[model samples]
Target: MVDSVKVAGIQMEPKILEKELNLERCLDFIQTAARQGAKLLVFPECALTGYCFSSLDEGLSVAEAIPGPSTEAIASVCRELEVYVVMGLLEKSGNKCYNALAFVGPEGLIGSYRKIHLPYLGIDRFATPGNRPFRVYDTPVGRVGLNICFDVRFPESSRVMALQGAEVIALPTNWPKGAESAPRFIVHTRAYENRVNYIAVDRVGVERGFRFIGQSKIVDYNGRTLAEADVSREEIIYADLDLKATREKRVVIIPGEFELPLFEGRRPEFYGLICERGESVEC
Candidate 1:
């Protein structure tokens, strides 16, 4: 496995109900990023099918199967370029539809992560909640975890991936206007706390009266901003990630006077309340 790899995040605007156009645009970006030496390229949430659907029927209409046409096209590109790609798309499985992210390598479809936490905003309101557990996949680059959009709001999501030895967490998001602070603070917080590379790729442009804030970015394991895209424009941000750094979880401040072990020091017993459902507990 390589110790370091170049990654890119594509920030673009997708037209609503125009799956064909969006797919074409995504293919272009994939080729461009791959040409620029990005081994792992990430795209925004709903990159293939736009978000903000009015009903489940609307989402299902454009939703495609995970290994269907869209993925086959992407897999062909990956094979040609010898790179890896993580993209967001609405998945249709029988009568159910879910917000999902697909991981594709040069070989073919690697894995997928369906959004587990559904929010009231956008298509997630009408889409089916994901049933799969959080997982990390071993790849040529490093141990990678996948999560979409609102999943980052819940610390447990990334924490679970971090616990599973994920070195890079790829997040495909569709952040809207008035949500600027998400990339500014929360993204960095997740990277710092978990000591894993966090790549959040967001879409831009207004769709059906709702505006999306771009600001797609990639943060290193030490919480440093490697690259960030413009807020209102379509662009690509690139960063070279060192996989070895993510494996070093120990922090030594002042040479032992202040030491912190991020993963080894967790107290699972006290954190059990986090898994409780249907009841609110006072802190």
Candidate 2:
């Protein structure tokens, strides 16, 4: 595995329900990020269809097929530049619609992650629920995880990814403006607790009634904010991540059945008593 990889986070507002214009901007940004020596690039959530749009009709009308035009365009870039890309899209799955994150590598369409933990605001009304909470994909840079806008708030999302061997958790977000501080703090906490790198990409401009906060950030395992962009500006945040740095700092065993199966031997029966109290609340 490579010791270090250069990555970039794209921060720009998307057009309201305009797929053509949004895709044009996506291609342009991909090229720009590629020129900046970015081995991996990430975009904000609901990039295909502007976030906060009124109806499922809008998401459905703009929804694309995986490996469809959106993925195809990015695939060409990945193939041509040999760089990996993670982008957000609206997916029209049978009988349901999903807010999905796609991972494209040089080999073509790598895998896509559907957004779990939909926000109670408008997304729950406009989008369908995801079956799984977290997804990790293998890439040249290392194991990469995908979590859409609201997934990281739960902690279990990032924890599962890190336990699953994800070196970096790339979040595609479209955070609302005026609330930048809290989200910034949250991403760092996720990274700090998991001992993994966290990259969050968000948009800058306003669409419909929602104005996005544009401070795309990358945080290290020590809860350090490595780089952050301004909340109202359009810019790319770039950084070179040393993959080995995470392993050296990891000292805890956060065990989960899906990703951290190594902890299966650990006193689950002993811990079951503790979980029973919380299980009623969770279920």
How do the residues 1-283 of candidate 1 rate in per-residue lDDT, one tens digit apiece?
A: 6688899999999887899999999999999998999999999999999998999999999999998899999999999999899989999999999999889988899999899998898899888999999999999978899999889999999999998999999999999887788899999999999999999999999998889999999999988999999988999999999888888888878686888888889889888889988659776
Give a tens-digit lDDT track for model 2, residues 203-267. Answer: 87877677777888988767788788997888888988877766654244553433432233345
Q: Which residue pairs come into collision in candidate 2?
A: none
Residue 103's lDDT within candidate 2 is 90
For model 2 the TM-score comes to 0.88
TM-score of 1: 0.97
Q: List runs of model 1 lying over 4 Å from the truth.
A: 254-256
Against the true structure, what is each candidate's TM-score?
Answer: 0.97, 0.88
